[model samples]
Target: MRSFYNSETGAVSIYLIIILVPIFFLQAVLIDFARVKAAEREADTAARAAVRSVLSAFDTELQKYGLFGLTGEPESSESLFSMIYKENLSGSSSGGFYKLLDTKPEEGHASLTSLYTLANHTVFKEQILEHMKYTAPIEFVLEITDKLQKPGAVKTLANGSAYAKDAEKIEKLLVKREELLDRAWMETVKLKEELNGRHHTYRARITELNRLSELIGLNTADGVRSQIKTLEEQIRSLSDSISSLNGSLAAAAAAGPEAAAAIQGMMDNMRSLQDQLTELQRRLSDLKTLLDNIVKYTGLLAATKLEIVSDDEKVQNLQKSVQELLGEAKKANDELNTELKRVSSAAGNELKVFEAFKSLKILSEDDFRTYQTGIASSAAMFSGFRSGIGSINLFTNANAQKIHAANDAYQAQMDEIYQKQLVIETERNKRNETIRKEKEKQRSKIQAALDRARQAMGDCGTDQTAGSVSAFYETLEGKDGLYGKYMTLNESPSNAGGSPVYDLEGKPDTEIQHAMSLLERLGQTGESIRNELFVNEYALSLFNYRTYGREVDGSGQPKPLHAMSEPSGHKLPGQEVEYLLYGFNSCAKNRSSAYGEMFAFRFAVRMVEELMDPKNELLQAGSPLLVLLVSAAEAAVKALADMDSLTDGKAVPISSKLTNPLFTFTYKDYLRIFLLLHSSDTNLLARLQSLIELNTERTLDHAVTYIQGSAESSVSLWFLPGVMKLMNGTGISSCEVRENRCRFISRADLAY
Candidate 1:
């Protein structure tokens, strides 16, 4: 053996044996590793098959709604997975490099690791979208959406609310203007009374002036003549006294010697001379008295001049008062007309201003000129009377012609003054009557308009029986054309509350609240086209609505409707989609809520369409506010009618005009659009599951949509039994193989 070890003859064979033995061990190890890797690959294949098999057992009821959820409990899922896993890995026994000692999956290893229920929002939405890909009416939904998003669509809807507010504001403005007119009328009435009083004063002053003229002329002549007569009498007495004194002096000188002697005895020689001087002085004194009487007559003529001056002053004052009164009357009339014009303009009755006050010009230029001429004539008459009377003498013919001319002038001036003043009075009466009648008419018109506006705003009930608003209605009817009756719904007392009814009885407030919150968010964020179409298709397919039985399909188009039998004893059988929309437990409440929201949306869209019509004069000559309100009211009525027909399984045209090739929508079509509008909303899956569970006896406690599966196995190592045993001792088995597979099974991938 030592020599063989040393010798080269068999050395190479020994060395080759040693090298081949180690190489064979390494090759065996490599083969075992290769077998382990193969087992792992098979495990992976098994896990994938197991998960797919578990997904294949989907809930059939859910599948009817175009949704997918794993059926059965977790244990059942594990059992199904284990069975599939074992089948996939099962091979010919004892035929390969490794013996199939046990094909059974490891205990606790064949499991569904992850699960997503139908309640999962993402899973539910994905399934619906997948289902909708083939069935959604893309062209139709896009058409409706385009119409709703037209130019000024949102502005038009906003204008409806603004219209209501503006109607109320206009009503208030009309009321205030009416009150202002009333106050103005009272003021005008007082001004009219004052003007009439001034006229009366003018007439009275004219009469008094005429009387004073006569009195001054007559009394002045009489008094001056009487005084002149007295003066003449004194002059005559003085002349007689002068003659008597001369005669008496002659008799005393010639006839009475004894008397002369006695008189002489009473006086000396100087006394006789003094007696002659005294007789001459008496004659001179009588002459002086005659001249003084003449002077007194002249003074009486000057006093007559004073009377004429006083009479002229009175005439001037009367003329001034008349002028002032006329001015005041004119000013009052102007103010009244101004107020009338303002109120009429505000009431949209500008032409009424002209019609009402056309003949109410109180003091025209011609009337003022006539008054001035009359006043001037009266002054001239007074001046003539004063001049003629002041120069009157004792003879009746002395100033008779002048007095006659003055009297004639007085008569002519009085006649002219009376005629002109009568004209003024007549005009004043006309103005006053016109103002009174117009005040009543304007008040009635304003009050009526205000009442109509208030009725539109729900501030007051309409008084349909009072007043004649047939013209107003007719005008509105012409403007609205075919939609007139519907537009006038707000004009009725019963429909005063307007649109969007919010009766919340027997409804879950929390659910509705969440639904509304979701709707609000969706409105802000908007829905994707894909999501919108999916929701439309899903709502139309799975739920029974008002006209569910009337659905029919045309070739090459989506089914117009889905037929469904009404479920018995369900809270909402025919209104399942409405419940989904509003989340109400009560069927009636859900229907009401759905109807209200539908009506509101339809009304808004219709209002925009109506406002866009160029022939509608609401934005121009009429109140934009009224147009908006009437459009809403029209849409409400038309929508109700449309709903009636739609629920009766008939299609109604979208536009009131019913244009050629009309775009029509049935109840389900409208519901589809409603779903599209609220695609991201609905907080829906939970409520849907609740309804499904409520309708069925089985509980969908944990319906799964997504799942992760694991499969593990132990394979016998053919070339390394001792090593495998050693590895198993350290909890590191060389025969161990594990594989994991994850899957998200949805309606899109629900293939068996």
Candidate 2:
């Protein structure tokens, strides 16, 4: 029993079974797991790569065709999957795999099927298909299958089986031929349809051409009539103008001498009147002096009572002085009357010249009416001409269509000729194949015969027998007979000749070339379209610029203000004025000091307004500081204006004071005070007060400290101290001393 248990075979068998079974199971499990993992990874990678590849292809196609932003069903997910399928097939090296896969649509989901078959020769095959179905909330499904084969399995196939290969080749060739024939037939049909359409168009073109010709003739006749009418009207207008000029010349000649004589007479009478008035003025001066002296003497007499006896002499002198003044006045009045008569006569002569001018007819109402009528008639004629041109265009287009139709028909004929040539080439190839087969059979038969003859000549011993046998062999081989003939046949060119060339030089034959020439003509047509489009764009730009009241000024800069209408009639603040000021400042700031200063003044005023309104957006945005700097520029303009006003008597007192440097200094102090009082920042207020004190000798320390402590402090503290210092330092009495003193003293110790 011990021997049996310890036996080598049984013990070894038990050990082998126990170890091999578990190992084999583990190996199989691992292999399957690895294969499944690899398949899953491959499927995920391929899905992502395929999606990317499809999207890339779609983008490329869109860019090439300039069809960006064009969306349709072709771009949908289902369409993308279809495209991917086709693309994969096209790129695939193995044919069976693609054909085995099925991609189909279901009710609400896409279904894709893939098959994988593994053979025992280490050969692997895989098929993958993807499908997408439905539009709303699109769904997709993918099916993948993999097949693996063990190595060396392929060598087990049966041999001597050429039938399958030959049959496949023949079937493929037949299918190719059928496809080619279908394509050729479709192209031919399309050509025929196009030719028919072109023929119809050509017939219409001929009718249009005839209409255009008629229109041309009518236009020529009407144009000539219009020219003649224009000439007649111009001649009549010239005649009327010349007649009026002649009438005016005659009237001027009649009035010329009388007008000159009257003017001269008036001048002489005015000289006499001037002399009498001068004499009267001298006598009146003497009387006025005497009256003044008498009033002085009377006042003196009232105080001294100085009297003279026999005052008749003095009275007579006074009376004589008065009479002389009266006589001089009378003479002056008579001279004025004579001058008035002469002046009236001269005025009458001038009226005669005016009457002559009034009677002349340079531009008549009838002439104006005729001119307007001509303009209207011209516009109507132009409209008719445009219509005629349009008709001509239609006629020419119809003719072009007819020409195209003829060309297309010729193209069809050429295509038929080419097809016949292909047929001939096919027949020639068949003939060559038959010849090759016959030669091959003949060679085989000759070889067999030589082998039999060699057997017959064996063991024979005679030069003649050997020679005869050799000769027979040579004859059988056709070395000097049929063989040579076969060689010659092989060396010769084919019996069939080259294809015939179509004659394109003749009138009807040229039509084919004309149709082909459309490719080149299209380039010229495109160029013409581009030129017309450019002209249209230019015209549109010009029209828009003009209508918008925008144009370039003398300096080649856009001057929007110049284009704007005048603002005299405008009720609101004119945009033109604002534009002018803004534009001028933009230009003048860089180049002109005078204009820069003016703009600065406006900017300062705007700043002041913003500062006064604390709620103003611009002020809150910190524009007041900029406004203050801008306002400072007003000092220069004000100074110049003040100088001008003082020298030329044009300056108002209020303007002079405002523009004075003292007022500017005072205003700056007031601004600082206001900013300090209203500012929420204590640090800014202290800094501003320090700045104001440093710049000017004004004392703002007290006002600044009070404002820093109390938000309710009045800005009057800033102005009053400065005003008191100004008055005391300048040593000039105030306009109203009491009021000035009260303003300064009342606010002296006031704080918030």
Candidate 3:
């Protein structure tokens, strides 16, 4: 055998045994390494699956609270791993490699020994030891012990070591990722705080707007009241002046011929003044009409102004409130930004951690390549988060600009309204000044006419004309005057006594002179009567007197009275028939013929009655004529009184009604038709009110529908479904896969 062993063939056989046997053993060791690698891949795959499930659950919870994707940070790999461990390994059936170790094992013999003891020996211990010598100082013992325990123990142990290293690297990266997630959560909280503050400010602004609306209506009401009061005072002053004038005119008629002439001249002057006063009054009435129109327009403007001003104030208040709220919101945004920066920093650190894992020599190139995919995915997710924050800021800026534009438009409209109001005020002042000047001029002319009439009456002897004047004056004083006498002459004496006349023209000469003196005194009483007549006539003309019962001739001129006729037969006892007849005829034939006829009839009838004997038929005949004149005068006074009462009744109620802008329009219509023969604008106020009511109702309905719909619609509805789809499809790939080896193993094992 030695010779054979020593031979070249024998030596070749020994060499072949040594080389082939070792080669076969090496192949077995390699197979074991492959099994170990597969186990590690399986563990990593399981861990990753578990971790991903937990992350998905967390994201769902965040979305439920409207906080999903608020922060720009990717899910941490360490957090993912920890969540998987807690969920899948913390309970029953928890006796895996993870359960065997009380804590993560350090790189030492104790960790190797523990794993080796648990694995036992089922593989070629000597070969495992040889392979292990190249890896760790204690790897020889660990590999041999692990191979002896079970048939698959050596492979499982080898694979578990690789998976454990992969998991450790993933865990380190996950730790940094967890820091980023924490920062993102803080940022989301800050942004939410800002939004809440802004909402509060908006609410306060709405309340202020409501208050401003009420103030506008109140101010308009006050302005209208002041104008109505000024009109009432002017009307009252005119009425009092007219009353005084009537008293003076009665006394003047009792004076003699010279006094009557003086009174006639004064009356003419008074008539002229009345014409001027009437013109002024007409102008005033026109001013009142214009004011009425202004009031109507102002009231309408006030209503709209109230609404607009209130809305504007509210918007401004809301802006201020919102600004304050935005300040809080900005703080929150700033905090969010800070948190984002922190998250970015943490995420970057995590990326560094992932990079550190990538640099590990223990991982195969293929495993490292899978790890790179996960790190890239995480980085991409952080970038997407930053993009989302930018979008929110853009939307906020756009809303602020829109609010500012609305405010500018409202201001421009207000300026235009103010300019129009100034023009109206200027016109009103000029009109008032002209009316005041005309009134002063009319007062001066009337006073001079009254003074001349009083002096002329003093020239006539009081006693000489007393009897005729007193008798005539007595008949005039009776209620029914001449009409009562005419009725008395037709009736029996008993009936005549009860009629409006009782024995006309039977007074003494002294009494007649006293009556004439009284009439003459009216001319000297001053221009108050003339001024009143002027004002009343002017007012009538201004408001269109012809429309209110003034008789218009064929020529379209106002003819207040038509014909005047004189009484021709009698004269006073001491007076010439020629003088009396001529004086009466001349007065009757005057331009103001009706007024002249009235005075001449009274004077002639008085003279004829005084000259006749009380028992004669001619004297009795004259008595009836005197009675008729007195009755006519009484009827005239009664008609005038009735007119005064009518004026008062209509004026009081109408003035009160004018206080309300809406009611003023209605009153104006009624007055124009009843007193001026014209109608006012129709039902304008009611139409406006109806329109406002209808608009309000429609707005309320629309608001209700909008509110209800808003509640039903989800906030997420505003987010396009396409956006979610894009994020789901592309964003997931950007997230880290911390346990690639474990994931590979599980996929491999499950492969059919």
Candidate 4:
């Protein structure tokens, strides 16, 4: 008790201790307040981010609504704002205080209820926000509002905006449609090509079947079946031809005037042949009925035939090769089917993208309807490749089957013939022994007959005009001496009595004799030798890169029509069409679809100029070009006007827009005629006609050879006075044919 009373020094320490407690508590209160403030700031930041994200969802919808003076976005199946919130902030971020709030919700709720229970103390709750864990219960409302606009102005804006969107979509659709249509047209062309090829195969098959039928004797079982197959093939061929003709008619109609005329002519021809077609159809129907009846009795035919087979090595080899081919073709068919499936899947995806655009409702419903239709048609055409390939497979299989059946039938026929001979073999052998002896006695006389044969005939029968195969091919390809219409024009009725006396063959002959004749015939016509070239002026400049292909290097060729500074050099030989050129007369050229009119135009102008030149020296030399156009004033112009003629179309009268200062020229009338010819559409009828003409078909204008110092080059430059269609297996770039048997040639090789 005395020591405790001595610690008066401890009293001041107690007072200091008591003062430190309040100071410590005050420091803790400041730290906790800082925590609450920081949490609130973090929560505010997250709220802003979440609200901003949700606001973005309204842009497109807002655009639509705002433009129309609407208060809000259009109703959608899903809540855009909720979607944005989940995507942007809360659900995924799970904003716990470390996230959005300071304490766990259950813990914070218990503490807040006991310590700060009243809504009146929500401010007190923020003071303790650090103790909270999540903001889920304390919802953050994010309003995405837009400024309102005048109703009338919004309507106008919406109309403008929707129209702009629709217009853009329509434009894109139109471009796509155009591309698809082009592809469709190309596919249509390919389809036609396939059909034509099929027609040829069908023809060959029919012929082969007929030959086999004849060999087996037409009255027999195999023969009758072969005949039925041939008739069916004929029916198929007729049907295919009719389909091809329909395409041909459509193409010709769109080709231009010349083809239009050809279309009319074809229509007229069809009218003439309608009855024949009806009869053919009737015959086909009857044949089908007959075929069905024959097929129904097939079990009876199989019963009469034994298992005998032909021992012919040729047939056996062909059958074996065909079987191997069928095996390979099957593999290829499988691969093609797989590729086609992939193509189908790709097409489906493309349709989905198109449908996606449609769902936006930004395109004019009616405006793009045509595009869909066109796309469907184009898709159909492209898909036709599947059918084309399938048909080829079918044909190949049919051919293999035919070969197998024919072999079996051949064996049966041989066996039947041999069976009869077997019954009398012993008697024939005894008779042959006596006959052999008699023949041996007369063997010396046989030498005299052999000697006479050797004396009369040379070795190997060498006097044939041409190979049988070659002759047959030539006949089938329509090359048996028909001339092109260009060379067949009679101009004058008086000369219609006979053909021209030109001694020319189809080959490129450059013998000294032919050169002399051509040189004399085409000798410098009047003023051509006196022609001068203005190499330094614009005269030659105009033709520098021009496609005249005419050698103007001091040659006696026609000067390019564009060398306008020198007006007196003859025009493209056409009287008024002096500037129209051969190479430049492209159907692909600006404002033109064909060059045949250009050819006829050249012919007409040259003819008129020749007659009216007042300076043409060729008139005295009995000019052939002029003679060919002797009826130019009447028949030539009439031919151009006639829809049935294979040249060009009628000329139009030159109007005001096309009036020229040069119209006052002496040949202005002919110029007007030329203008009319150029303006008029000349369809591909003439070119197609020329292209399909046979090699032996005499050309209208130039002959096969031209003078190059007597060195002839085989070229088919079809742009001159005598261009003709190039024929198969002969052109410079033509592919070689590889058939073992004689095959008909086609003129589709006329690319040049």
Candidate 5:
């Protein structure tokens, strides 16, 4: 058999049988493996298709707002997944080498592994950015952002009021300082005149005394007696002048302490003059006594032929005493003149202070320091003058009576002096009363101006009218829409007389605070708010809000918003954006809060625009406080008008100075700007969910943004029964040629 086994033909046939059997087995195994791999790939494709279908069943309503979420329940998504999975598997290449039989998805395997909702900021932001990528002009958005973020383009609403308050305080203080200096200067002028008059009268009295003393020294006994009569006349005249001067001093004392001190100094000089005159009179009398005694004794001695003693030496001594008194009086006159000149210089300096204080149009730190220095210098001058003159000795009424007693001729001049005193008293009382009233009036005026300034600041409310602001608001009557209504509702009655001048004291609106917080957080992270702004713009485009008169379409055509679920089902107001911002169920509360915030931001923008405008001369001239107040009022009114035009869906200038008329923005644009300033992501998202629920009549929890789906397909094994058996208990059934099968799982994860 082995050799016959060596024969050629039969051996070749046997060799063919041996080779063909193993090759056939290997080919069948490879075909089954290829079929299994192909089926797994098909399963993967089915799972992906199924998950994609689920995503495709997104909430169409949300798409209108540029958002995406899986509609319906997760359980309902299974049926949709099953249908798509089966369809894709069944459609897989049936004409291929290996047939995929009973290629059915494993039941319960078509489940979502993960599901993400719009509550996630990442998903929500992605969707918004996606929407804006197609709809919004990227360059336009960037341009608006760049413009709003320009230096000083946005400022705090309180800045204007703060500037105004500071300016007002400075102005009031300056005016008060000016009034004080002017009063002191007026007192100085009057006192200087009185001092000069007293000085001239003293000089004249001293000269008259000198002449009398000289006449006494040179004349005979009869001539000396006559000269004594003239000296007595001069003494009587000086005494009357001293009495009048005493009354004048008392009158001047009532004007002010400085005036009183100055007049007292003059009265002291007059008293000294009276003393010198009295001394001269006494000397003359003594001389006269000596002469009379000599005359009587000489008459006796002449009868007895004795030599008469000459009294010329004593007369000459008396004349010398008079000359010395004249010299002392002249010295006193010179000292008084110097004092008066110094006082005049001080008064002139005070006048300069008043002029300097009035000259300041803008209050800089340097100007403030200069004013303080000037005021301090003037006050020191007046104080010094008062203290310097106070050192003079007091002239008592008893001393004045001594002068009067020295000459009975003083009594004859008493009536004229009394008349002059009465006139002076009447005039002084009138002038003092007038000055007091004037001071009070000026103070009242300053207080009134301050009051008006404070009132203007608080009048930042929308209802306020300033200068041309009345006309401005009137022009916005119809276009401002709900802005005016809400402004009136939110208007604070008054400043309460002394409320904080700036917006610093009161608490900001809760909505505004929340919005600002969002902005701050975004700023801290250095994150661009472009996406947030886009989302807000999307919301404005899709949602409902109070408009000028009617809601406008994307094409700027007006339309009725009767699609708001038939009125009875409407849970939100017409001002839905306002409600979202404020989260108040009450329409007025929501609308007013939104309006208040909008006004605040708009007012800030307008204020910056107004302040930064080079053409605005208000800050350069007139009362700076008034200019600031008027500018604030103008900004308030302009913001109102801006709100008007925006609500009307008309383009309003971004900046009055640098705005491109063609590049202006509308209501939705402004709303987007405000949204960029919004603070809390969680709060905003929660509100968005609530809004979606209300609008779509769907539960927020059912909304899905991301979902992970796993699917399996069953494929029968025909040729690889042995390998199938090896894979058994490892999620593969024991292989029988026609009936056994294996299952393959595929995962599909998707996000918004």
Candidate 6:
């Protein structure tokens, strides 16, 4: 190489230079090529970053308005997009790699679309749009759907509205039940007071009769007769009093069937207990009179002993009175024996108090059964809803807890109001207070959202259907638009009177209205309010027909007649009504088809069946009330032992007979004993009142449970479905850019 450059080899060096010239020239051209390529790559990167920035703006606006742009609230899509593009373009257009005109209008242009035609929203459109220097046009399309159904905005909204309405219905039923319980509690109080008064009277009579009792022995005839006559008069008065009490009791039973049945049970116990005491008193009075008269005659005989041999007319009269009194004593003793036998008979005469107890047992048991059945369906609905809505993640578990608590609080208030002995107005008042508060909370949330929308979009009135980007896209694409079929599917149902309009694009205010509907339904809950849990309303109607013994018309509504137990053609599994009456056929009815009637009629029939049982065990032993009555009887027996003149085993037989009747004192005797033992135990009445208060509370709890369950299910059924449809279709997307990096939202997140 040194020789080639040396002047000694000048001729050879000149030839080498000629050869190197072409190589050096080629190397310089390659170097310039590398620089140009590097410039192009940098320009491409800047353009990608700028376009991505603009896309982020679009995403923000689209998210605010709902990806489908169906939120009837205005959005700042166009203005924000324009501003973001200007900022991004100006910032990235620097670095001197490419040229971009700073002039307005024709100098800068952008086309946004779902990709149907060039003429639509097109400044330019091609596989690679012309005159779009250094980059390719970026395009993205949103396709929302629900694979579960006709997944789209319209279907989602429609289902949501239906679910919301159904939830309202369930909530209303809870409120209705509370009102019914209140009424029942009031009636219970009235019945308790009346029966308690009768009980007190019977107790007093028992005490007086015991004081009059003594063993069969002897006494003066005139004094004995006078005492006997007074006793008989008192006994007759008691009988008349008892008869009047029974009449009043019957009137009390004429109240609503549910209350009447419960009240009637107490009345029967009171009556039977009173009768046992009355009979016992009558027998004891007879024995006392016979014993006193016998003692008097024996005394006269003793006094006449010294004068007996001489025939005095007075002595003859005294002798005759003694014999007559003796005969009466024997007869009285025989009658007492006979009455004791009947009182001891457990199967034939039947223990009186037990008969009343049986009715109560059956009624209470049946009521519980009804309650369980009612709640079971709603509970299932809630479970399903909870699962479904969990996926939607908009309505939270906390929201469910709050919603259920509101209903429970409303019921609790009803209990307090009823305890105040308030009437129907109290029911209305409680509803108003709770519902208003809940509604206010809903309204406040809606207001906050609306205020935010106003701040963002100015005074664009939340009906953005006209100037909205969504509308523009639809108009641009028309029948062949990417979302044309979705739009058609989401169209609203025809208007129903007094219902809110359904335009697919829900207004911001619509959320508030839905909340109001929920409160109204909850407030409207009553005895008449019915629901079909885990099934459609129409299906519930069919279930009712099968369970309630209804005949169905062609239209599938139940047609009930006055006579119940008519066989319905259909049968649902495990329904007692179906087994008894043939089948329940309708969801609701005018008179005999109601739930109260269903139970009332069945219990009434069962009451008769139990009363006819020979065992006298209908009182189905083992209750706090029964134990109290029996204990009272034992006290009476003890008091008899403490009584004057009756302690020398003279009253032992009577006490033994009463305490050990049928190997144990019968319910009748027990009831008599209870009245006598705790005559002043006012706390008994107070305890019973507590039970009465529970009537409404128990009902309200069950109702609230059902409502909450249905509400949760409805959110899944109505609200979450809309979003899920979007997730299945629109949330998933793909794009390939020939000369650009596509900037787009890859995930759909919502906070509704």
Identify the candidate with maximal TM-score. Answer: 1
Model 3, 286: alpha-carbon shift in Å?
A: 68
Kindly list the per-residue Cα lDDT of model 5 for residues 1-752, writing each as its tens digit.
99676768687788999999899887877766666767777777788888898889888777666777886877788888888888888544466543444466767767775566665556666776787677766666677766645533333222333333334455454445434433433443343343334334433433343334333343456766777788778878878888887778778878887696688688778879878887978877786875665455334424321110122222233323433433343344344334334433442122111122132322234533333333333333323322322331221344223322322222223233334434544664464455455445434443343333223322223422344433322322223312222223233221111111122222222222322333333224334666666666555545665552354555677755423223223344355565555544344444555555555555555544554432334333333333434444556556666666655556666666544445566655555555555544444444555565555655434568888878767777678567665655565432223357766677888777
Estimate the overall C-alpha local distance difference test score of candidate 6: 0.30
Clashes of 5: 5
Q: For model 2, where is the 10-residue window of minimal lDDT?
A: 140-149
lDDT ranking of the models: 5, 1, 6, 3, 4, 2
Off by over 4 Å in 2: 1-6, 57-70, 74-76, 82-752
Poorest stretch of ten by lDDT in candidate 4: 139-148
Better of 2 and 6 by TM-score: 6
RMSD to the hidden true structure, all candidates: 18.1, 61.4, 61.6, 50.4, 22.9, 42.6
| Greater-TM-score candidate between 5 and 6 | 5
lDDT of 1 by residue, 458-575 (tens): 1111322223323322222234321122223222222111123333221221212222332333234354566756665666566666545554443323344342312423334466
Backbone steric clashes in candidate 2, count:
13
Better structure of 4 and 5 per lDDT: 5
Better of 4 and 6 by TM-score: 6
Segments in model 6 whose C-alpha atoms lie over 4 Å from true places: 1-153, 209-752
Task: Give candidate 4's error at residue 100 in angstroms.
Answer: 56
The C-alpha stretches of model 3 lying farther than 4 A from their native spots are 1-401, 424-428, 443-460, 465-486, 490-752
Instruction: Return whichever of 1 and 2 wins on lDDT.
Output: 1
lDDT of 2 by residue, 1-752 (tens): 99877777677788999999888766654443333333333333444444443334322222221111112233353355444433332123336533322211112222222111111001100000010011111110000000001211111110001111221233233334333433433443443343344335434544444444433433333444455455455545545554554555456557877666655555555555555555545544544444444444334333221111112223233323433433343344344334333433432122111121121112234432332233233233323322333333323345435444443444444344345535643664464455445434533443343233223211111212445433432432233322222223234322111111111122311221222222122212322232222222221211111012232333546435321112222211111111111111111121122222222222222222222223333222211222222222332234334323322212122222113221221111111212222222222222222222222223221111110000000011112333433444454422112321211110111111
lDDT of 6 by residue, 1-752 (tens): 77565657477787899999888755654443333333333333433443343334322222211111111111233333334434433223444532322211112233222212111112111111221122211110011011112223222222223323322332243334344444444443443342334234323432332233222223445666677667677677767767777776777777767677767676876778587657758775775757664655444434333222231233233323433433343344344334333334534333233233222211133443333232233223323333332332122344434434432332343334334434533654574465555445544543443343223211212322334433433322244432222222223221111112111123323432332333233223232211111011111222222223323333556445331112222222212121112111211111122222222111222222222322333134322122222222233223322221111111111222212211221111212222222222122212111111121111111111000000000001112223233333453422111121212221112111
